[model samples]
Target: MNTQTLKKPDINILKGQTITGKWHKKKYYVVKELGSGAIGTVYLCVYQNVQVALKMSKQSHSITSEVNVLKAFKKVQGHSLGPSLIDVDDYISANGHVYSFYVMEYISGDDLPNFINRNGQEWLFTLLIGFAKDLQTLHDEGYVFGDLKTDNLIVSRKPARLRWVDVGGTTLQGRAIKEYTEFYDRAYWQMGSRKADPGYDLFALAMVILRIYYPNGFSRGDNPRKTLQQKVQLAIRSQSLKQLVGKMLNGDIDKADQVKDYLLQYVMKQNQQTQLRQKRLSQKNQQETSFHPTLEVVSILSISGLCYIYMTLFL
Candidate 1:
């Protein structure tokens, strides 16, 4: 009776440590920190042993824009580029900051942006096909991934096929969700031009393909800056980069297939040949290095044998 009456109370302790998960009335357990945005930190969360992305707000109206943009995509008849929504929760932070949390589908793969930075040219023609198709789809639906850099894209994490992810629909993808009428990305800048415009995004896409799939001994980025601009612009008439502008407006991109084919055929093949040539040169150097050591040793042995014979004869 005494032991039962004097039981010590157990208190949940979470002091001094920044942990992510369903904590203190939260719904999920935080596994690892993926990244942080203008809002709060994004953590790889777990619930029932499953994974998900929990993005908590950093400031006012941050999650509102993201949620609005995501909701806009859901209204579209057929769109699967963006991550599927799971759940949303809102609360006030310890510092009196009101924040919203979004539970999003967790993509188990390498982020495309990081992959491109590391291995951009390993598989040229294949990635071009999928990427071009997705870009066309986005164009048809009047959405441009504001940030088209490699980091925004996702490739396979294991030794499997590379995949692209993070489809930002509006100019920011996380911008004003209600205003979906605009089909242009404002951050794209023309090479010789000043402001960032919609056409710049298209040019950016083409540039990504060109830089990654250029198939010559010279490579996509090896050429002088102006020369590269000239090469890309050559296919787009008018010294300006307006090739993608007309097609984007027309809402018809059947011609893009031909362009992708031409890029892989002309660009990737030439680049592969160049890489092969360099590899052969390296192998030849190794062979020369290997042969040199053996020859030096044999020459030394021959000289030593002759010296001993000559010394005996002289003695």
Candidate 2:
């Protein structure tokens, strides 16, 4: 007899189900569905009384690929850009269908757009700097974040740094980008190809910058390049920021480290200019103060001399 097709588990039914790893023998209590992606569905679950994120999918190959990516993240030096891979195992559902699943660190934070809106635009540069560094690490390790959008990013509190999530779209350098959103895709804009490279990610980063300015996102008109440039001019008043983003979009700045360096240099130049202006103003104020006191003294002396002359001539 042919086996019955296994349908995607309903959220309501999965909420209270216990997922026991067939090999690891660890159990996780499903709290709720965090998100559903093309590859699989991620759930917020409690493992050994601690909250974590677990992704399960019938496609075992895709699940294994994502698990390898997570492992690669751990091998990268410095910061861990992606979530830490906790456990990898198989779970059998009530229907006796085996599903591949992996548990990862539960990153609790606000999405990029909401975080920036609530905290104000002051956080944009800092977040961008941190994000560039993280991206640099990934690129150095031979990976490109194909789907570079705000939706796949999270801002954690305390130190308030940017963190990447939903890394399923990450692809190795030189290969075709596995997945991408059109708004952020250079190919969609007719600016470049779909081949995975630093430029591809940088172009997406530029779109992400625009996404902040146009929260609802703009449409690609008759000319995508012209449309993007017009929007950049309209939204970004800062010449430096506009130039940086423009370079990224145009593929002029292709590397993540270059982005970081450019931002840091701009920030440094701005600080120097501000300090120079402050110094000049301070000097001008000091000169005015000295002139006022000297003028007062001269006035007093002139009046006393006139009074002495009057006394000498009349009395």
Candidate 3:
């Protein structure tokens, strides 16, 4: 065998290494790699005895843009729509190359598909409503989530919360979208441009709904738009929701507020119907239980009287 030395990994933070915040000087221990994409890799870490997610980018420019977008989101932190930014810093790799990274709130939850699997699909209406409201908040803040998708969304239980991750695609309104998944992109549907608009995000949201409703058929190697339209028409019987989905596909994403309101109404109506159903069921059960004992007593008394009279007559 030829004598050669193994080289260390380049520009990437390895697991178990300690990363210190440049400003606060707080140290975080890397647990494991959460994910890796074109721009960067995310790691689960422990900071101040609390778990947090840290994103390290290969290119300094990419991390810089993402950090700025996250900073903007911080200005409107009251909404709690996206993960809270913790800190930003630079790390020197084994090869002496400087890499940029940022820390953010670690969301402990399942993605959309897994969440539906665990919670049942009945909660979809409420989940979508919450997501739409978050998007509305981002829109109100003059930003658009360019890369909205199932993977980027995390849903929590108990209270049923929704949160967005991956700020690299965030863009200011009226500019071209910085990034997007092809299936969720309006340009792929031949419906609109790649401009960063509220409608663009809405179109992606529509795709998200379609994916949730028809997990297997949404991307079955056919014309996605046509297939989606046909499936929605055949499967979804609710006229109001169908109309909302149609508007989203048609690039009318500015109507997110309307969709949100409609979903809210639907959820409220469902709750009322559920309560009514439960009440009726309880009453029916109560009535049956009350009637059966009286009937049993009357039958026993009649049988006893008949038996006594028959014995007297025979004797």
Candidate 4:
């Protein structure tokens, strides 16, 4: 049998199967497939009774660099941008072929766009600021998240936060971006090179915001660049920080702090409005409660007087 046929069997990881680490011998129970991409397949798994995400790739070499990148990210103390790398190992199948896999914290949440739709768009300002800060952290560490897109982001509540899931596109500074979605790629817009820099990520970040703002309208036509530019102009009218977003799309905004500051201001303004509205509602409710008893007492007395009159007249 050829290599393609040999690797084919390992790709279909059945549910409930156990994948054991080659070196440490730790075993993880496969729960279900989470997602699949060009490089590998990810599965939800339980390791030592704790939920984790396991990524398996047929070509082990393809993910070796990503593993190193993740290790570097893990060293950044208090980094909440993405899930912590748990373990790395290779699993030997029954046929004795080695398949490489790595485990990371399982993020339980909806994707960025879905979460916004479900939770309400009022949270977008906070979410975007948090996301920009995360990118800032990564950039500060001398790395670029080449493929920054909504699908790669997860937003959770109970302490609403955002986390990056797929780290395959992460690359060190000065290197060309390894991977990117067409719409999110700066090169696709002919605005800049694909070099892994802060500008590249910032440009993609701006695209992400525009996408969330106009999900259906931003389409890829024959003239994709012109189409995107038009969409950006329209988005500016509908979205806050129009000039900032325009600058970002043009590869002008590189500092994440700039975006964060603008978005933070918007979030604070929205929060104040919400609080004021809530306070007014509370006062209205209080007034209605205070007036309710007097009306009830007057109504009871009127009914009693009517009953007495009826008794005197009819009895």
- Top candidate on TM-score is 4
Q: Tens digits of per-residue lDDT for model 4 on 190-293?
A: 87899999999999888887877777535567876677677777755535667778888886778888889878887778789899999999999999999999
| lDDT to native, each model | 0.51, 0.87, 0.82, 0.84
Candidate 2 ranges with C-alpha deviation above 4 Å: 1-13, 273-315
Q: What is the C-alpha lDDT profile of model 2 across 7-28, one tens digit per residue?
A: 6463233788888999999999
* lDDT-superior candidate, 2 or 4: 2
TM-score winner between candidates 3 and 4: 4
Return the TM-score for candidate 2, rounded to 2 decimals: 0.83
Quote each prediction's TM-score.
0.52, 0.83, 0.84, 0.86
Per-residue CA lDDT of candidate 3, range 33-132, in tens? 9998878889999997899999987677789999899889889857786888989888765566566789999987888877877787667777888888
Per-residue CA lDDT of model 1 for 241-291, tens digit only, reads 234433432223334454455555655677788999999999999999999
Error of 2 at 49 (Å): 2.5
Candidate order by lDDT, highest to lowest?
Answer: 2, 4, 3, 1
Each candidate: RMSD to true structure? 12.5, 6.8, 5.4, 3.3
Per-candidate clash tally: 16, 0, 0, 0
Task: Count backbone clashes in candidate 4.
Answer: 0
Local error of candidate 1 at residue 125 (angstroms): 2.2
